[model samples]
Target: MRIAVTSASGKLGASIIKHLIKKIGNQNIVGIARTPEKANHLGVEIRQGDYNNRHDFDKALQGIDAVLLVSGMDDPQKRIQQHRNVIAAAEQNGVKKIVYTSIVGNDSETAFSPVVKSNRQTEKDVQEYGMQWVIGRNGIYIEPDLEYIENYVKEGGIRNCAGDGKCAYTSREELGYAYAQMLLDEGNNGQIYNLVGEAISQAELAALINQVYHTNLTYEAVSVEVYEKERKEALGDFLGTIIAGIYEGINIGANDVHSDFAKAAGRAHKTPLEMVQEIKAQE
Candidate 1:
């Protein structure tokens, strides 16, 4: 079956394409990107697709049997319509199935709520589009913490509003594996899977990082206001607030949800320790 992955230049999209290639062969996969040239190295047909442009997606999705819609990174309000553009185009082109990469979070508790609400709207849209659909509510990605290892070391530990709450984290590679199955397996149609790994607290995550990197990092809990202020100072208003809001959600146990990764991928999700080890080996 021919499958298309949107936002192909992105890390998540690229990873999904990698797994899809192994399952369906590169000849049957298409990478759609806002800048097709950036994704040419993926070694598949690259088509121009911008979430904001329905005309471009109309052409990008042509002759495709299914498509993966990577959530857009625009203003939450704008993302709704942007995602609609792709869905509308997909339907117009007679795509048989569509999958979406969504996230799991409370819909009204944090600055990140708007983003979650927007994803929900798209989820509803995909379900009602009269085509087969699968939605994966992705857990918080663990790569950022690994990428910021140096900063954590400099700060002497991990500090956030998560307190003792556990977060279900998943890696891009794992998500890619699950998404490939979701796109290819008919059993996954009409399902909304929570693609998450084992849930762990910040302390547990820090310990896992220590095991991999041999650091003496500790987890420190702070108030939501304090953490939000700090993140805002470090990352500027928009991003910092969102990051802080995510932690705040964690603080309230919004991220500690049931996982359906095994059902989605046909295998258990990798442990946090395993993920850390894999990334370390790559480094």
Candidate 2:
């Protein structure tokens, strides 16, 4: 049974590929990346793949029995189109199973509405293709918070507009392992798994970080305007808006769904506390 992973050079993709290699051997897996050369180190067959190019994916997915299609990093309309191209190519190439890494939002009118709409459309397209499929709506990754550790330390707290809202933050690395398991397992066709951890609030997160780092950091609930201002001043408007939107999305319960992250892995999923500890250990 041959399998392929798109965007195999990315952090999550590479982690998935590694876990797959351990389970299925490198020879049975194909790592598809925009530049195949960048994925050569993965020790699997490297193929040039692009979500925007049907021909590229058609050629890359050749002889593959199953595939993991990581959603493209683009605006909603463009991303959905790219996903369509990939689905078309996958179907055209006769691939049997597909696992998509989607975000956690089924409603189109949510705070992070655009991505939800695109993912919903993509899910519709995948289902319309009449192939065995699994749509894994992944939770907001907790790993990204590590990037703000220094800032939190400097500011003596975490600032966001997410007032009392909780999020089910997940670890990207473990999520990849679960993906590999799902790909290897049989009879999960047409299932939609909400991959998430326990719902945790920002105040709890701040307290945990303080406990771990031995600092007196607090969680401050600011207005959207103030949060946006601080982020824009620190990281420019584009990234600032994106970052603040994550908190805004959380406030609206975008990532608060009950999920299959633990069931998919057939084990207890890591908690936010464990995830933070793991991050600290790595650092």
Candidate 3:
């Protein structure tokens, strides 16, 4: 079965491609990305393209049986439209199935309460299509927090407003492996798997980093306003908005949740403590 993966340059995308190569062999995989030069070393049939480009879509979908559509990381306003383009191309090209990596609990307006509306619409569009579908509604990747933890522990100051609000963070590498497994299995069609691992708070994460570094990493809880200002000063305004948006998302219980990545993998996913330990060992 030939499978095509979009956004092949990203961490998740690259990991998915690697997993597919291991499971199905390199000959059956296609990696589609906006920049093919960056993905050249992936050693798959590289389709240089973007979601909005119809010509690239036609070329990428040729002779492909299934597709793993990683959500585009462009403008939020254009996200759904880009998905529509991919779904339309898949339908027209007669691709048998599509496994979409969607946001967690995107089906509920209250879950993506702030962003659910668009993701829900995209899910509907996929379901409406004739192709068989499996939705991988994934949670946030904890691996991104490596830098966050490094910043906090290196300076001995951890700042936040989240007090013991547990969050389930999955490793993108493992999550990619799970997605490739579903694409290979063919039994998971029409199923929506909530891909997540252990739940831990920012304070717990700071403690883990401190334990690994053999230093005292302090924690501080500030008002949302102060956190936003500090984050803006440290990071740029755009990234500051995103950081504040995530904390807000956590506060509103958008991400303080859990799911069954264990069942999906038929085993327990890496825990927060385990992940931190792994980072420590690597360091």
Best by lDDT: 1
What is residue 53's positional error in candidate 2, in angstroms?
Answer: 1.6
Candidate with more favorable, higher TM-score: 1 or 2: 1
Superposed on all Cα atoms, model 3 deviates from the true structure by an RMSD in Å of: 2.5
lDDT of 2 by residue, 198-266 (tens): 999999888878877777888889887788888889898767776777778788777788978765766
Q: How far in Å is the alpha carbon of 182 misplaced in model 2?
A: 1.4
TM-score of each: 0.99, 0.94, 0.90
Count of residue pairs whose backbone atoms collide, per candidate: 0, 0, 0
lDDT of 3 by residue, 90-161 (tens): 888999999888776333322134354566677788889989998877777766667666676566677765
In model 1, which regions exceed 4 Å deviation?
none
lDDT of 1 by residue, 50-132 (tens): 89899999999999999999999999999999999999999999999999999999999898898999999999999998999
What lDDT is reached at residue 250 by model 3? 57
Residue pairs in clash, model 1: none
Kindly report which residue stretches of model 3 are placed more than 4 angstroms away from their true locations once superposed: 105-116, 280-283
The prediction achieving the highest TM-score against the true structure is 1
